[model samples]
Target: MISSKEIKRKPDQDASKHYDSVIDKVLQKLDTVCKEVIDRTNQNNQQENEEARFGQQVKQKPMNEERKEKEENALLLQLAEKDKGRLHLFIKLVDYMTVETLVSINQTSMSMLLEEMKKERKNGLFNTAVNFDVQIFTPDEKEISEHLKCLLDDMIVVMRNTARVISHQSMIGYIKNTKLGELLSEQKENKDCIADVQGIITDSIEYQNIKNEIFEKVTSDFQAAEVYVNTNYMRCKPIYEFLNTWNQGDFENKEHTLDIIKSHVMELKKWLADINFYIKDIAKGILNVDGKKIKNKLQPQVVTKLENFKDYLYKLMQKKANQTLTTLQTYTSNLSKNPQNLKEYAEFIEAIQEAEQNIKGLETAKIEVEAMHSLLKSKFDLNPLKNSDIVMMDDIQAEYLRLTLKIKEAEELCKERKQEMMKKHEAEFIKFITNIQNTTSSVNKGKLILEETQPADALQQLNEIKTRSLDRFKELDKNYQHYAKLMGLSVTTNKDLQELEATYNDRRMLWTHSDKFNKLYEDLQKNIFTTLNVEEIEKEMKSYEIGILKLRQNINNLSKEGRDKVLDQHANRVGNVSQFMPVIQALGNKDLRPRHWKKIFEDLGSAWQPGKTFTLQELIADGVMNKKDKIEEISAKASGEASIEAQIEDIKSKWSQLSFIVNHYREAKDKFIIGSLDDIIAALDDHQLKVQTKLGTRFVAEIRPSC
Candidate 1:
């Protein structure tokens, strides 16, 4: 029932199984080897324990019978001769064996443990190596000294128990050799013997038993110390294994995970520093080396973690930069199609601003990244996810402004179109005009609206209306001229009238006089008779003649009044007429009459009255002249005796005020001639000539100054 595929896979599956079985067998063989090693170590420990017990029993024998009896007798003889011999040989041995030797053993073992721990960290031995602290190995001098002191104190207890056994054996020997020894042996038969020998020897036996109990306690303490020191290896082994397999390359999201890695590295660093401190301060003398070698092994791992973290950050930044660049490029592509409307233009402007902001953010990120790694600058350009500098931010800003202006323009156009839609069309506007009773005012209002709303078409429509009105006016003019001819009156020609009307019509489209044109149009529409008939012409002519006669009469009345004033001033004033020439010039030829000048000269003969002898003040009071004019008249007649006297008195009173003014003018005239002011001349030289034809030449002089 098996398929061909399964049949073919069966042999491969069997081969895989065989391979697994072979691997399992190898692992089992390794396990068996490890077990054998452990068994051998246990056997060695049992042999050591048996040797220790045999050594203890040998040490329990009498001191004199021991191998060093001769040397011990020599040491007793030497101590007896000394005046002070507080140092016991037994104490010296205890100090060296328990304190010094044991401290060396512990320090060496701790140093080896710390070395292994460092190797584990370097290889990334533990899953949580950053969080885990290796076991406390060697401590500072004070702590190690304390451990040594405690161990030495326990050894001292064992040494004291041995000394008790030696003392008890020595005392029993001293008693057995004398009556006390005999007495103690005889007292042993009695349960409660009062003899000193028996009581003392029995008490010594009991004290010997107490020494054995003390030795047991010392052994237990020594085992406890061994266990405490051995913990260093047990705790450090796992960390080493973990570090051996740890790999920085396996991490993901380097930027986020780097924090954790860095934190772990820092914790590992602290652990190393702790070990270094212990080695330097306490274990240096014991191990014969400082822990400086371990730092080299650990530092590389810290660097690797940090490098991986930086790579992660770089990749992250590059990705974000690429995204921003893509967004900007997309916006740029969209903008190439110029926006067709205000809304589209506004959207374009928004896109440009957003792109510019993204560019600014990218620039900031680039600066931050550069601050972290200066060497990475060139590498960043080569990174796959890295984006080149967005050089289009300025272009984007320009585009923003351009789009803004475009939107404004489109809005204005739309607003104009809306206004045009709301208002009437040109044809409709003409109809509205025809329906209005006050066509002038209505046309004026419509013209203003059209000019602002739809200027070109509106003006053209208004001009057409004006042309039609002009045609009607011309027809009416012809009729008027015909009526004038019938009445035998000189008529204004139709051609001349048409030319004048044409001038006004030319300005019909202008805002000025627009209302007047409209009114003219309305007047033509209302008049049923297009022409002025003979009777109407006669009446119009009579009205014209009456207006002319009234105008002439008014002019004659004004002339009579003006002539009287001239006569009165000329006859009454015994003064020069030169001053009155300015008054004649001021009247102008258009306002003055010839008869007024004739009367002025005629009255100046026999009618030249001296008038009442009046002072200059009196002349001003009479309103005949101002004080300046009166003073000028006196100056003109200064050759006369009376004028001289009047001038003398006037000069005496006003000399101070007028002296500076007179001198300033006199000096100015003198300097004016010295500068050759009147010699400077400019002329416009223009000549017209024709070959074998008449020609004219003209010149105009002008004064110019150059400085």
Candidate 2:
């Protein structure tokens, strides 16, 4: 049987089970999202052929109707021609501003030309209806205006329709062919036919095809190129490839590159997303092919920047390919340090705060425990009981009762003895009692004599006296000891109560810091009080919490870390901020840019026609970057020096002045001994460094085939 002893028993609450359930739920949700993503990918993959087929269908348009209905469509053609003519005039006037500004000026000038024509007509010096609106414009004017209009429209559609098999029908292509044919006999303002007319015609199919082919894979190449520009062309080749490749495989193993692409997108989006991001003149030049000199200077810089950017993007692609052995967890161990994982680290702070708060509450709880101990100790006297007189009270009471009963029985015998003794004494004392006894003795003797006469009365009187005496004595002895025990127990209760009070007072001090207790409580409420299992909560925190907090704090503070840390953050933050990485990359990329890639693809198709092994270097020298890797024979003996060394030497020669100033400043300084010499040395050193560092690297590895 269980003893009826009350004790403080500890309770077992299985918190871990609850926590596990929560974690399982969270992972299940994530799995669901993953499944959905996979399902969507499968769906897209299944429909790719349909998309391609649709593209082919979109290529078929009513070309014959457009050709035959020229007079009815004369306004559009006339406007197209006028636009080309205006483009030439505007190109000369390109040093100025917007199409609005240029067009206003052009319109004013055209008005005067019309006015002159009107005067000539009045003088009978002109022929036919001189309608500027109806008349066809010059080739350059039509080229410029229509190009502008096309840019404003869907450029992809225009490029496709112009170069596609079904719609291989650009006016420029037709006009260029006719122009080439009549070049010897007659020529019209032929300054703009560019790179080479004969070479352009020779590679016309290739050029057209290349122009048709996407130079920029809008998502990958552009995104990568965006990063390339931001990081500079440090890893230019990889950026170029990334920007130039099929982006349908864009996200395959592209975690790092995705971030970079995102960052690139953000920066490039800053330039492109905003209609007002660039200057108006630049925008106007970009919008319309005005061939303006002012724009010409800027174009090469932008293009070069774009090219260098492409290189950087290529490197990023390389980086994406070069996966490290360490897992993501290794990189995300202390997310606070990794700016990339900042988003995930925010919650970790909350968890830590909760833990710390829980610990604080535990301190209070510990104090409460001590209070409970004091309460128990006070209320229950578990302390040893001192030896008491009560221990023998029962035995003594029993013995006393037995003796009383025996004595009562012995009363008769004692009375008989007394009577016998008294009989002898009575005779002798009779005379003395008679002589000495007063009324009481005489009465007692008389009563004894009466009792002798009536023994029952005397016996009754004796029994009553004995019973009352016994009861009185028993009450005194037993009640006192029992009362003492009760008193002792009361004392113990009071003592324990005092102790508990003291303990409570001490515990109360633990609650003195209300802020801490409340905060801890709040943290508990925030972190774990709800569901329970949060093991990976810590893991997730380790992955993303800490970093997020640090970043948020830093952002809030409007402060920055050390330069090295900032640099690291900058690299990491490249993609963390933006989702528009592709646009920037495409805009900045040289290889993938429609202008460059289109030419290359077209030339490749033309040159590498079915049965030919063309001289690749010759094309390369002519600024044609063909899209294939090739190896050519070379003799080590004939080339006594290494290709890399020779190329390096050439690079050194080109950047000789820059290197000289930066490299030999210290040597130059020591050679000077005077005060002015020190200043001269400092100035020269500064100048040299400024020149060299600012000049940047201009080395081309392709030249050496090794550098």
Candidate 3:
């Protein structure tokens, strides 16, 4: 009873199972083979034990053999001489290695030398391999000889010792033959005596073995500490996913919305899956291989509804038929009876007949209304009936049924006519619906591919549309939310619409004001900059007023802290002005010398010292400059120095030291602020004017002693 989806194997399980079975079978075979190998290993182990024991017996005689070798040193010397004499080729090659010959010269000589070296290296390797092949020797390093040569020589010593041991053992065994029975009896006695000490010795040996085994075990544990791993595969993914899912956020005051959202998400997934082929077609269309996307998307659709305008028209017609039948019955019966109410009955019959004839027009109106309704509904949902069973006619059929109360005598005719109309309506509706459904379903599922339509551009358009729709939808949703809280279907929407219109008008007015304010702000900036001889600056210095205004504005706009910085900038600019002022001042005083200038400069430099002062008239006398000539003379003189700009700086520096107190007093006298050069001049005017009334001397006097 499991669905196919549920019955399907989980991912990788089949491959995993197959791999496991194959590995298990291979490992089982390997285990059997390993068992056979262990058996062979045990058999080999027994053979190795026997050989080792036999070797141990031979090892027991090595102590005795060493003593014999010490006693036979003289004979060994003789054998060594014979062995050395056999080394004729080795000695001859060593003799050839003189200093210059060993160091190869040209390519030819190097080749010959390499050949000789190879021969020596080969001999060394060969001697070591052959002589040391059967000897028990430790590889001890010797600095004087090469490694192979030393190994071979050491092995020769070991081999000679082995041979001597064998010879000594053979000699000892032969000598024992001379006193065989007594020696054998003594040997048996010694063996019995050694057997008596074996138990105590074995106890000591067993204790040492236990201690060694413990040491080995501890070291084995140390080595085993290098690597480790753990295993846990069950329930990890499921638990992690559950934890992650539950840890997410929840909706506020609308928990059921989550279920609805989940449903939407599932539907979205279905839509995406179903759209895969459509997306592929889109991609192909983008490649411009085909171009029929929009046409396919916009094809007109058909809708069927028994509960529509056409049905209402059919019912109206049926009602008209009933009325007609009733009117005929009344007219015929009245004509036969010759009654007084015949005129009234005949007039009623005429009215009913007229109404019945108008049914055709009513049906036509229903058809028109139904056509428009069908267009909107069918385009939205082609098979809406497939998903709905609840029904109610909103058109002609409903109207026709409603009118049945006016004519009880013709109910059967009305009912019969109603059935006929419905059958016809249904058949026609179905035919139209089926044709549209087939067309829509068979429309090749065209992609909305654009030939040259930029996807990004189209996407942007789509995004704009989506954004607009979402904005409206969000507004609608927000309204609904507020509505749900306030009314919950209590208030009609028109009231809210009125409120919205008022708010929109207010916002519109505010936006208009904002735009006007922006325009005025820009005009304000331009107007401010244009004031204060902006044109005069251009005429005089070719420096547009823009730069000057900008500079001044920037200074004014600076933070208070930044503005309160040192007047060094003013001093510097004064110096620059001073450079041009002096030459002009000296124009009328051609007899002026550098010495006079020095004296005036000194007086100005010292005027503002703690207790010092120099009168304005005195300074004028020192410079030999009068009021009429002051501006021109100062400017021309100041502009004359080698570094006019630096000289101007010197001039301003001197002016500041001498005039700072005077300038301060003048500012208090006239309420002048010290922002510009003109302010200083204005302060000076006020000071002079004030002092002139207070018994100040008008005549010039030398400001400096030397002057």
Number of clashing pairs, model 1?
9
* Candidate 2 local lDDT, 1-707, one digit each (tens): 11112111211124324433543454355345435544554554455555457856655548786456444445544554444444323322321222223224333433453344234121221111111122211122333333323322222221212211111122222223343325512423453322122232224454344333322222232233233323432222233333445242454345443345445534433432222222122111112111133224433444544444444444442332222111122222322231122122223333333433443443343333333333323323223222332233233334334433443443343333433433443353344233222321221232322312333443444344335532343343343333333223121122322332333222222222222323433342354221322343234324332443444443223222322232233224332322222222222232222223334435445442332232323433443322232101112211322333454465556555432223334668556332234545565676567445433433232233433
Looking at model 3, which ten-residue stretch has the lowest summed lDDT? 226-235
Considering every candidate listed, which one attains the maximal TM-score? 1
**Alpha-carbon RMSD, candidate 2:** 55.1
Query: What are the RMSD figures for all models against the true structure?
Result: 33.9, 55.1, 36.0
Steric collisions counted per model: 9, 43, 31
Q: What's the CA error at residue 582 for candidate 3, in Å?
A: 95
Where in model 1 is the C-alpha error above 4 Å? 1-177, 182-301, 353-707
Please report, as a residue range, the 10-residue window in candidate 1 with the lowest summed lDDT.
Answer: 698-707
For candidate 2, give the lDDT of residue 408.
Answer: 40
lDDT for model 2, please: 0.32
Best by lDDT: 1
Write model 3 residue lDDT over 398-460, tens digit each, in one string: 544334333333333333344444444345434534443343222111121222333344344
lDDT of 1: 0.38
Off by over 4 Å in 2: 1-291, 326-707
- Judge candidate 2 at residue 528 and give its lDDT: 26
